[model samples]
Target: MKRLLKLYLNTFDGLSREVWWLALITLINRAGTMVIPFLSLYLTEDLEFSPSTVGSIMAAFGLGSVVGSWLGGKLTDKIGYYKIMVFSLFVSGLLFVLLQYLKTVLSLSIGIFVLMLVADMFRPAMFVALSAYSKPENKTRSVTLIRLAINLGFSAGPAIGGLIIAGLGYNGLFWVDGITCILATLLLIQLLNPKKSKVLDEVKVEEPYSAYKDKAFIIFLFALFLFGVMFLQYFSTMPIYYRDSHFLTEPEIGLLLGANGFFIFLLEMPLIKWLENTRFNKVILIWFGALLTSLSLLILNFTTWSGILIIGMFLMTVGEMIAFPFANAFALQQAKKGNQGEYMALYSIAFSFAHIFGHKAGLESVSVYGFDNTWYIFTAVGVLCMFLLLILKQFLKAKNIIS
Candidate 1:
């Protein structure tokens, strides 16, 4: 354990001073993203609404996130990531404030919708900046570190939200998240000056930032879209899966999340490094995707307390750790010099759209088709993704797109 910590610390030691600061910015902004997980529970429990109603309300955020992902990136290209994040954070912060004070169901729903949009927009810009400034050699490690910081910050957010909500109800929770955003905004302005595109100038930026009319980037994006939809199950479907399908209690579900985060915290850096190459990453992704989709289906039948559901979540997270980084790294690698913001933004849009669809499907599947069927559907989706990836891999291999 001590050796692992030493190795993790050493990676940052090798990064340029500027990159270290960038990671800190990620840590700050992500630490405050506490409102997201708590929002659904807040609306349902505090506002006294039903699950289905809350599901629809939650869907509003997903829809807004889709817009944020596309528009945020576009704005980043025009104005710069620094300015764009400032606006995004401010808009999202205001929505968080609205969430704190607002009481009406209609008002609350709208507030969440706006908040989701703003929050989602802000993410891709940060990613674009990270990809821009980070050392090419350390790209995988850097990305994993950024991800870890996010998970760590978000980990605090949810635990704190649980406590705050338990004591002060949903309003107090929103107030906390609001304050966090405001603080993060102040830090963001000081940390990321968009004029600081100097770090980006050193690298051999990819060829002209085109639409990637090169069909490879296009095929890769579609594969990513499928992979993203599968990950959304953790938030949208997995929760319901554990509760309704697996008969786990609320506290138990929370523990499951905690466990997943814990393992990720432990393994993220090394695993990410090992999986850096596109082909290796894709292979691991395929394996994990297959296992995760199969486990989702198996959990429906293996609902006994021998920790089957927990194992299922672990498998799912493993798939997540493999697939998400692969998709992100591959997408970033394929973009042209000036198009980093655009590709990352479009990718974010794809993710947001997935969340929107995935959540609705999760809700409906649990309601109409039953939990077991949802697993089967997820499995089918994974299988389809695997086939798509296989064809893409072959094409890339022939063209020498991936080494």
Candidate 2:
């Protein structure tokens, strides 16, 4: 037991105190993440919106995310990450409270868009902060620590959210989510002093559009966009599929989703530590991870059994664990000093783009072609993204862009 404990501690050895505080803030924020996972279900079942309408509303949230990420990146470079993060958290919390009162489709759609706009602006800022806090050699593990906190909080949130939905209902979810965001903001103010945080001292006055010029990075971002599209199905269409196709209740769906978080919490840090010590190529590892994501979705075509759903989610979580943190680390490596915010912001946009298209694709396909075909489509896209990543690796190697 002592040996195992020592090994676990060794995996997290070099990360700074600020990184741990960032992880704590992430855990607190995500622990109340009751909204996005259930937003589609709420629009469909509770409000009686059509699937298409739900998709549009969800896409609206993505639209806001797109704007938020771009704006956040620019702002982080100009004003620094501290102010941007604190502002995003407090305002987004108030927006969540406002979301509870919205009823009609137009109102809810507009509200959701605005809420996500404010909420998602924090993403790039947070990434910039993470990079600032971490030493170069420990960057990947630093990011993974934050992810571990996120997954741990996710494990708690959905299970508790299930109970909240069961008792106090969806309104209860909004309240809890809103309150937590406010609390996270307060913690940030108290714990993260600008003078104490280890931000990069060098500043370069590059144009906002500078990151767009790197062709290899552009290809990488596109591949990430595709991966994001497929991966996001877990939050978007997957819940609806479970509810409508399998006839599972909210609590059951929560448990299934929660299981993904539980697995990541247990495995991600150790897995990254192992990978760091190995001779395996980062590109190849990411490709395998992408392939696994497709396999996770393809498994759904074979069976809709409850046991199978859990298994599929587990595979998806594994893929996420392998791919995402490495992807972030790779992006950080590719970035020039003083441009981390711009690079990270561009990467964040890939997910926002996924939000824009993934929900539309999943919801529309289900509305038109049916669920099985939607899964098939997702599987095909994931495979295609793997090829893109492979090509990106070769390009980077040929150009000596990565060591």
CA lDDT, every model vs. true structure: 0.70, 0.84
For model 2, state the Cα shift of residue 86 in Å: 1.0
lDDT of 2 by residue, 1-403 (tens): 9998888888899888889999999998888777777888888878889987886777778788888888888898879889999999999888887798999888988898788878888999998888778887788899999989887787778768879899988988899899999999999998888876665423354643467787777888998999999998988799999999889998899788778877777788899999988887677777878988999999988965767787888899999999998888887766654366778789999988887788778888999999999999999999889989989988988987652
**What's the TM-score of each model vs. the native?**
0.86, 0.87
Model 1: lDDT of residue 140: 58
Q: Write the per-residue lDDT of candidate 1 for residues 1-403, one digit (tens) a residue.
A: 9997887665455455555666676666676666777666666767788877887777777778887787887887777777777777777776777777777767767877777778878877887777767766666566677777778888877777778768987777667767777777787767666554447424344455564465767776676667667667778677876776567889888888788789888876767666553456454465465556556545656555637776777777776666666666666676544566777877777777776677677678778887767777877776776777777778878987652
* Candidate 2: Cα lDDT at 131: 79
Top candidate by lDDT: 2
The RMSD (Cα, Å) of candidate 1 is 3.2
